[model samples]
Target: MTRPWEILTAATVAGSGLLAGVFFAFSAFVMSGLRRLPEQDGSAAMRSLNVTAQRPPLMIALFGVSVLCVVVIVRAIAGWPRPGAVWLLAGAIVTLVGAVGVTAAINVPLNNRLDAGTVLWSQFLAAWEPANHARTILCLLGCALLSVGTIRWH
Candidate 1:
């Protein structure tokens, strides 16, 4: 048997990398898209960029958190006796549950409830500022901790 914790640690590192690539990478993509939106005509590019801004980050956070949970669960299953993992796992849980889960449960539904089309994006940004910021900070911190764990080993 490969043993569960080892599998989990490997998976978490890989999953974190993938999440970083997809979500954190979009910060630049979104910035570029925002920068170009004014110069470029209103077109598919705007829509694509807006969708990316609205989504991939959240999706990535959710995926990363879910994987973190999996890592812990695998540890439990494999009977890995390391106690230090609890810190990294707990940090991941707080960030994921508090940041990603709450945003999806609350803010997203609010966005969906609004009448379709003709939304003031500025207004949306303003309304979501606090929540969005919270999610961003928490997830980034969690990712950092996971990175440390990846390097440190138990």
Candidate 2:
């Protein structure tokens, strides 16, 4: 009796929540721990992390959720005026723009600069942490919206 859209919406909610938690971890303690280290050590550790993050698990989670957001957006638009369409659309947009977009536009570039040894660790932290916080908030917001939308859908 579960419809495809229902499944998709549920998955999106879960995915958003997962990403939020990941971002929150970084904002909450990972970055803090890094900051405690000497500048060169911190920078080196972060660079290593950046390389590891490009691997499949995190990449799939981030990009796979992104792909789902796109689908959810299309579904929300096409199914407009339905019970939870607006909430679903809002959730997808928030996640796509706030989380994924911010990561692509801001965080990755900062990481690249850090990796290349082009930017100081302090400078990277100054910029990256705030952006990470923003994405964390956005992902949480998206998850909340999607959860409400899913409940309303039923």
Candidate 3:
């Protein structure tokens, strides 16, 4: 029978992977597609996306994974010296600080500025795309770490 920690580990891996894919889409094509549009159209479309992104599905995925990361950190600390503990802890921290932290600190503010018309599309794209790329890398890294940890778990 599977334990609670096993379930949590699996969920965290899945959540990080899901977030990685989402960010990858943005980094790979969404931002590029927006950039290809006329400035006003791109800005307006991005503003609409910013508003739409605040809805439940993404909010849950993002914030929920953050919460899960916290729990995983605690578990990793408690289970220190265990085979997978270090990897798990590293994964949780990287995802929390690298992915979610960057989103909260950099991306969201840029999105807000664009939505509020305080920033132009070109300016927003210049900053937001780079940050999105960073978060994408972090999410993929976290997912990889978590997968390794899960595999090492006995």
C-alpha TM-score for every candidate: 0.57, 0.96, 0.96
Model 2 bad stretches (over 4 Å): none
* Candidate 2, RMSD to the unseen true structure: 1.1
Candidate 2 residue lDDT tens string, 1-154 = 1588778888899999999999999999999999999999999899998989889988898998999999989987887877888888899989987678999999999998987888998899999999999999999999998887778765
Tens digits of per-residue lDDT for model 3, 25-50: 99899989988999999898888888
Q: State the C-alpha lDDT per candidate.
A: 0.52, 0.89, 0.88
Q: Flag regions of model 1 displaced more than 4 Å.
A: 1-3, 26-32, 35-61, 64-81, 110-115, 128-133, 149-153
Clashes of each: 0, 0, 0
Order candidates by lDDT, high to low: 2, 3, 1
Lowest summed-lDDT stretch of 10 residues in model 2?
1-10
lDDT of 1 by residue, 3-63 (tens): 6756665565555445444444434455345545553332344445446656766566556
* C-alpha lDDT (0 to 100) for residue 107 of candidate 1: 51
* Residue 52 displacement in candidate 3 (angstroms): 0.9
Give me the overall lDDT of model 2. Answer: 0.89
Candidate 3 vs. true structure, TM-score: 0.96
